[model samples]
Target: MSTYEASLASAAAFMERHERFLVINHVNPDGDATGSLLGTGWLLRQLGKQAVLVNEGSTPEKFGFLPGAEQIINASRAEKPEFDAVITCDCADFARIGDVKEWLPLGMPLLNIDHHPTNDLFGTDNLVRTDAAATAEVLYDLLTYMKQPIPQEMAVCLYTGLLTDTGGFRYSNTTPHVMEMASALLACGVEPAPIAERMLETITKAHVRLLQRALQTLVLRDTDQTAYLTITAADMEQCGAQNDDTEGLVNYARNIEGVEVGILYKEVASDKVKVSLRSRSIVDVAAIAQSIGGGGHVRAAGCTVHGTLADAKQIVEQKVSAALASQEASV
Candidate 1:
């Protein structure tokens, strides 16, 4: 067996060894995180395991159609539950799961399933497949490896994970294998057009309004090949947009021709800003994010800066500008 196959076998054995599971994903859950969380929860329950799915926040409205999404609880660190093991999906590190660890029993076995290259291997049995396009992709492999059947609901959740994480199959990570997994998911009764429309084409009033305000703050660094935008707390308040509404806003900058790097600065508080970065090709945005105590994939990454929005913008601009320059120099 290959290394990934061996890891899959081991992870399957680990799952088979446990009966009760606590499932979780990262904070500020995205499509991949939420999809994998819901899919895994469904899989566990299907196997007659006692699984409690929890997230740091409520599932995004777009994903409410996902099967078992309503089952995800917004848990507190104070609620200690009995679990044989913890199954983390789409979380790069334990901290990304937020403070839910505080409620977990000390030294409880953790099975980390993720696709990020920056994964910490923090789980007792780590099944971190960085080469896979999404955690759902990894889960598909696991399901096949274990000879498990996929129901239509589980397929919807898994397909959503693959769809969003691959940027609707537009990102570089969309390989033939990724496409094959998606085909298999579709064969399992996932209606492709509807899911895509709901996730991509559908938008709320708050989203477009917030986009208008954020775009009004657009700034371009012509020399560095970067385009940027910012969303202030005031803008979000005025538009009544939640954090999820800002999901794909950064793509507005990255999608522009000639723009190599796109940045979004979201003011979470007066003294705190969340920075999202996207690069067309040349820049390793994840490394830039990691330099500022954040982490993510190569073309896309994010970090939270503890400073005023202006300070955060300055810090992120400096980082990406330097990175662009450095990569250009090396070339």
Candidate 2:
């Protein structure tokens, strides 16, 4: 069997042996992370396994429309359930799962399923497919291999993962295979319009206000090839924006003309900043994020710096400047 086939077989066997599972997603779960976790939970239920979905953070209100959103428990409320196995969805590394990792049973088998190229192979059965657009895509293939029917609810969850991770099919990661999977999900009764509206088009006043504050901090560097914006915790509070409200704000910086790289520096605490990076092309933000002990895809990645916002900005600015120079020199 091929490497992927072998990994899949091992993952399938691992799932088959486990009766109770703890499904964990990354902190500040995005659409792919949330959908993959919930979709996997649903798949496990279909197979007569008891699966509990938990995250370090709460599911954003916008994603609450997903079929099993209400079932996901926050880490604070979760008990150390008698789980036999732990499956991490859409997380590049164990640290991304945040505090929930502490609750896992010792020596339980870990199945790491993700699409990030920077995955560290943290699972006993690692299913990391860099070519897949989203972890949901990987899960779809795994479900097919396991002969688990993709119910409408699961289809909706999977489709949402595909949609959001690809930036509504606008990102470079949206390959032909991604489109094919989307078509299959649609055939499985996943409605595109409502999902698109909820995940993309809809926005609240608070989010808009937060965007305004973020936009005010936008800066251009490296001859306008790099653009970045900042959002402080105080700004989030003043705008009455939840942590999820800052989603997609970096797109504003990237959307600027001539800006190849867009970044968002968000102050999550007094001395901690979470940085989100996006690139149009020619730069691997994943490498940059990994250098700072974080990881994601080539075009999009993130890392957290434990320093004042000014210090984090200076450090990231230098890294981005050097990356842009290196990309230019190669050409």
Candidate 3:
């Protein structure tokens, strides 16, 4: 059997020993987190095991259509459901569990399933594949090994996660293996068009307005190669937009012909700014995020700064500029 098969067998055997499971994802979960959670939850239910999803925050409005989304309980509000084991999907580190960390019992078995190279392997059983394009790919293998059937709705959830996380297969991480996995999911009646439309093509008027406003603040530094945008709390209020509306704004900056990196700084709450970074080539945005107390992959990463938007933006831009300048000089 292949390594994936072996890992799947191991994970399945472990699950078979557990009666109750608490599932969790990282804070500010994206498509990968939600999709993997839903897919895994479906598989767990098929095995006749009790599973509960605990997320750090509310699912984005755009992804509310995913099946089993309503079953997710915010970790902060949950009454601490008792579980024999804990499973975290798509999270690199323990801190990413946010408030859900409080619910896990000490000395209890924890399973960490992820695709990030930065994963800490904090669980009793860890299956982190750095080569997988998305965590959904790993989940697909797990479901197969467990002899669980992938229903149409489960296919939708997995497909949605796979598509968005890989940037519709345009990202560098989209390998032939990922394409094969996508094909397998497609065989389960996955449709690409509507999924793309709903996740990427569809946009609300307020979201459009917010994008325009955020774009208007775009700034290019270091010979117009690094472009970024900043959105203050006032900007969100002015556009009547929520945090989810700014989801893909950083891509806009990264797509610019001369830009090497794109950054979006948004006021998430009082005295805190959420920063998203994207890099076209060469630059490792994850390193930048790590320097700012956040972590992700090389191409995409995010972190939050505990300061006013202006202060956070200034710090990020300055640090990013220095990093780009060093990269250029090295080249």
Candidate 4:
């Protein structure tokens, strides 16, 4: 196993050796994934490498304001292009890259950059740093090591990554180094108020209606210490909302008073449902997610259950209830 530092050196070397790169991020990208993907693109361009940035799905509309976001191609529409290597950011496993994998040439070298501890280390060179607040933090170190300067556009991407992963710097992962990185990015001319407003404060009318529909389905379980919200296809279609509109809906349940666990169940199909898990205290939501074939940080994680919404709810509620009963669920 390559040490994180060793992988950093190797990843940088791989970037240097490659003249063209396919850069991607996880499916259903959040700010961290989108920012890291674009930030990596900017970084590669700084090294004079040609980077074709792709995402397994569309980036959230809120992130469209960031520099270079317009260039992100969805996998379904992306055509195969020759490249020296494939670099994925903020993805814990190869599966997270989704359909983008289909575009890669066989035996392509991969530089896996991420901050998830659950990362399978699937890259030829892995730079997984669990201590870092976000993947952008890892990129910041790489930029510093390469003696590269952070430009204004790059600052927007990196700063957005740090901001989102830390829940606007309110999550437990927000550390001193994360703060310093944000400070440096701010120094690079990242306007704090506008980005924060667009990212954290803004929501579309369609999303508001979506939220209205979701809240009506909200149910409090586990003696009101857990909150459950469901979003069905009917609601989505009626509201004219896309997956991006559902971005932070799970947080609504998670922020409720006395709610230690919040779970959102969204219908993916008649027989498939997507689950988002969040915790307010000691629960290891990531473990709960991984138990059912998904992964993410402890406070926030997600999984997909192959069943109707009711069936998925039954499974998730049981698991979350069990975890809450466990010692880890206690404050």
lDDT of 1: 0.88
Cα lDDT tens digits for candidate 1, 264-313: 99999999999999999899998888888888899999989999988998
The per-residue C-alpha lDDT of model 4 at residue 246 equals 89
User: What lDDT would each prediction earn against the true structure?
Assistant: 0.88, 0.91, 0.85, 0.89
TM-scores for every predicted model: 0.96, 0.98, 0.93, 0.96
List, residue by residue over 211-318, the lDDT tens digit for candidate 2: 888888888989999999999999988998887888889989989989999999999898999999999988899999999888998999999999999989888888
Segments of candidate 3 deviating more than 4 angstroms = 1-6
Model 1 CA lDDT for position 162: 93
lDDT of 4 by residue, 71-188 (tens): 9988786677778898999998888999888877777899999988678888888888988999999999888877889999999989988988887999999888988888999999
Query: What are the candidates' C-alpha RMSDs?
Result: 1.4, 1.0, 2.0, 1.8
Candidate 3, residue 2: CA error in Å?
7.2
In lDDT terms, how accurate is model 2? 0.91
Model 4 clashing residue pairs (backbone):
none
Question: Positional deviation of 200 in candidate 1, in angstroms?
Answer: 0.9
List ranges where model 4 is wrong by over 4 Å. Answer: 328-331
Q: Compose the digit string of candidate 3's lDDT tens values, residues 1-331.
A: 8776777777897788898999998887888899999887887888889999888788777778888899998877658887899889999889999878877778889888998866778899887787788889888778766677788899988988899889888899998888988898899998888888898788787778878888788888878878888787888888888767788888888899989889888887779999999998888888888888888899998888999888887888887888888897998
Score candidate 1 by TM-score against the native. Answer: 0.96
